[model samples]
Target: MFVSELMSTRLITVELDDKLSAVKEIFESVNIHHLLVIESKMVFGVVSDRDLYKALSPNIGTRTETSKDTATLNKRVHQIASRRPIVLPVSATIEEAIYIFNTHNISCIPIVDHEMEPIGIITTRSILKALDEKKITLLATCKTQ
Candidate 1:
């Protein structure tokens, strides 16, 4: 199946200039693990709960200054977020999505349209659910046969 068949259409996003405090609030309020960073409706990068907390933590050794003069404790997401994000087109097949996820060691991928505009997000959980459902269907078909 195509990614659009299993991807979540309801997306929660944040902008690069948005305050870390606000991102934290959204993370708590929505109970979501990750948020897509967007700019001009285009996918920028992903920010996870861990990334936010790491930024907020007062640990000295972890902090790195950004171009905006803000300190990031978790430099990984912060640095990546400063650049254009890697995005997958919504028309991509599940197998292709799996390949990207496996090869990149990324837990999530933003689904974009032909114009590279953000549309939705595909996560490991979503893929697992689709696989589980397919397994169940196969088992049922085998029993019937």
Candidate 2:
């Protein structure tokens, strides 16, 4: 399967000056685990939920919204986001994605166009879901065949 076939087209992105507080809100609103940090129509870094948790003192999800939490969240996303991320083209195969996941300690990868414009994202969950669906389809076909 191709990455484009299963990658999510809906993207959540933040600029350098964007706040972690805003990121927290999006994280809570969506079931996503990663956000692409973009600048000038190009991806600069990636900010995972784990990264956000480590940057916050008490973690934003907790009800303990202390002044420190507010202050820390107000920090620019660029400050807490992991920079210089490796990206994949939408034409890449799913096996390539699995290879990347195995070689790197990353759970999410950003999908971009040839011009480096962000188009979609692929996560471990998406890959698993696709694999399971494909298996089910194949099994059903085998039963009929």
Candidate 3:
């Protein structure tokens, strides 16, 4: 099947300049693991929850805020975002998507169109779900055999 068939249309994204704390809040609020970093409605990169945690590490560098207030501090997403993310066109086959994911060691990939506009997201979870459904169908056939 094609990526467009199983990709998620309700994409969660973050701007390049958005603060790290804000990204963290969105991560927690939505219970999502990653966010697509977009610029001008185009895919720029991706930011994961792990990236935020690393950026907030005390030993990384300067501590922008003291113990009192941390949420107000600013940490640009671009500074920690993963650039040159593994992106695929919405028409890519599931096998192609899996290859990209395995090659790059990524769990998700952003789907873009010819214009490079963000269209949807394809994740390992979606692939696994598809596999599970296929397995169920196969099992049903076995039972009837």
lDDT of 1 by residue, 1-145 (tens): 6888888988998777777767767887996677898778878788877767766645433366343434443244444353555688877887788778888867788899988788888888888887777832443564699
Candidate 3: tens digits of C-alpha lDDT, residues 15-100: 98999878878887886777999998889999988788877745333566464345333779989999878899987987788778
Q: Write the per-residue lDDT of candidate 2 for residues 1-145, one digit (tens) a residue.
A: 6888878999989998998889888998998899999999998899999988888777444786777666887877988888878789999987788889989999888999998889999998998887677732543564698
- For residue 137, give model 2's deviation from the true position in Å: 8.7
**Candidate 2: where is the Cα deviation over 4 Å?**
59-65, 135-145
- Which ten residues in a row are the worst by lDDT in model 2? 134-143
TM-scores vs. true structure, each candidate: 0.74, 0.85, 0.80
In angstroms, what RMSD does candidate 2 have relative to the true structure? 4.0
Listed per model in order, the count of residue pairs whose N, CA or C atoms clash below 3 Å is 0, 0, 0
* Candidate 2 local distance difference test against the native: 0.85
The number of clashing residue pairs in model 2 is 0
Cα error of candidate 2 at position 97, Å: 0.7
lDDT of 1 at 35: 89
The local distance difference test score of model 1 is 0.73
Instruction: Please identify model 3 stretches exceeding 4 Å from their true place.
Output: 58-73, 135-145
What is the clash count of model 1?
0
Error of 1 at 123 (Å): 0.4
